[model samples]
Target: MAAKRLREAEESGEPGRRAGGGLLPFGLVDVDGPSMVPTLYHGDRVVVRYGARVRPGAVLLVRHPMRQDLLVVKRATELRSKGWWLLSDNQFLGNDSRDFGPVPPELVLGRVLARVRPSVSWLAPAGRLERLLCGWPLGRVPGLAARFGLSRRLSPLR
Candidate 1:
């Protein structure tokens, strides 16, 4: 039924629905490497908006500066005269503008809108780990707490 609905939606040139999730504008882009770690895991899925203004501090997907067809996800650092400066959130694990310099503003594909983490059982013995995992600054506290039977705790950083 869900697939049928998706097909119908596709045929009609409208958003598709499947398994309670609607079609995405920018679609799913798998996060790889530790540059976005402690926030977006390696296998995490991100929803993006293509061709949007690359705002500073926003995560973005862009064509790798050296390799045009290769896409990379990084934080927008600065908008330079040549293009946009891209940097990674994780200083130790990222190889971004610091290495290849500014990326062509046109190569940028999209800005990340949101991400849904994989579900973890708080009732299990690894509840502490679960808290640490979902405690990133992306605003998943309520959902994480509700899923794990944990009370709202103070901000992880503060």
Candidate 2:
């Protein structure tokens, strides 16, 4: 149903409408796997903004290239010749670009804004730290660390 809607939307040049018959700038998605662990978890509910500009390191909700009926959440790693090189944060658990290769931009449904519901309590501290690090004077630390090649060692997406 979603595939059909997406195809129709693309064909008609109107991809932002909800399936239930309304205009929604954003949509909700239920995370089902541990592929995005530490950032997202199983059962976590996320709000995705449609038509948002996707960049490297941004988490996105995309249709599986090989299986359009399936939806998966992963981080956009790089822009490849074929499409976008996406990767799972939990390298040990996900089947991502490493398995199916780059996905076309059309397959991307939306960019995840935030996790509305988290499945675990133990993971909150890490989430809080991430939010903190992405704000204020500390937000500049990641880029500075990246310049020193320090972030590559600490980032799980690597």
Candidate 3:
């Protein structure tokens, strides 16, 4: 339902954006790290629908549970007894549930709908192929991957 509302606002080209004082159904957030590599890269701008439905495999914008001042983009990998178990697609570089345990649903700010930077297009949400590719040996590269445009994960967002 929340996703539908956001799509409606996007289709209507609504002007009541949260940035404009009136709250739109969705907002834009810039991706800042490689935690969601392949699916989301540094500098990518994403459409986030607040209160959108979060299910396993949804890309999410969340407040870092241990550092509320920090916002991180992660994927909902499982629903635990306590809360959502989040994971980073970039297995080699994650600071996720493995490190912080399950995250309270309250920290989930929104669901990522699409990538609007470098290009404007809807995402193939829950892309298993992309997720699989992220864990390849290349994913461990803190030095190599981003330098060669390993995937759409490292490209011009400007």
Model 2, position 97: C-alpha lDDT score:
86
Alpha-carbon runs more than 4 Å astray in model 2:
1-16, 19-22, 119-158
Model 2 Cα shift for residue 85 (angstroms): 0.4
Ten consecutive residues with minimal summed lDDT in candidate 3? 149-158
Against the reference, the lDDT scores of all candidates come to: 0.56, 0.63, 0.65
| TM-score for each model | 0.59, 0.67, 0.65
Candidate with maximal lDDT: 3
Per-residue CA lDDT of model 2 for 1-158, tens digit only, reads 12233334444545555531238776666677778765776777776677777766677778899988677888787887778888876768658887888899998877777666753222112344555555677767646422211122223342
TM-score of candidate 2 to 2 decimals = 0.67
After aligning candidate 1 to the native by TM-score, how far in Å is the CA of 143 from where it should be? Answer: 16
Clashes of 3: 0
Better of 1 and 3 by TM-score: 3
State the lDDT of candidate 3 residue by residue for 1-88, as single tens digits. Answer: 0122333343565565542123765777777767777777787887887778887666777778888756777877778787888877
Which candidate model has the greater lDDT, 1 or 2?
2
Give the residue spans of candidate 1 off by over 4 A: 1-24, 119-158
lDDT of 3 at 93: 76
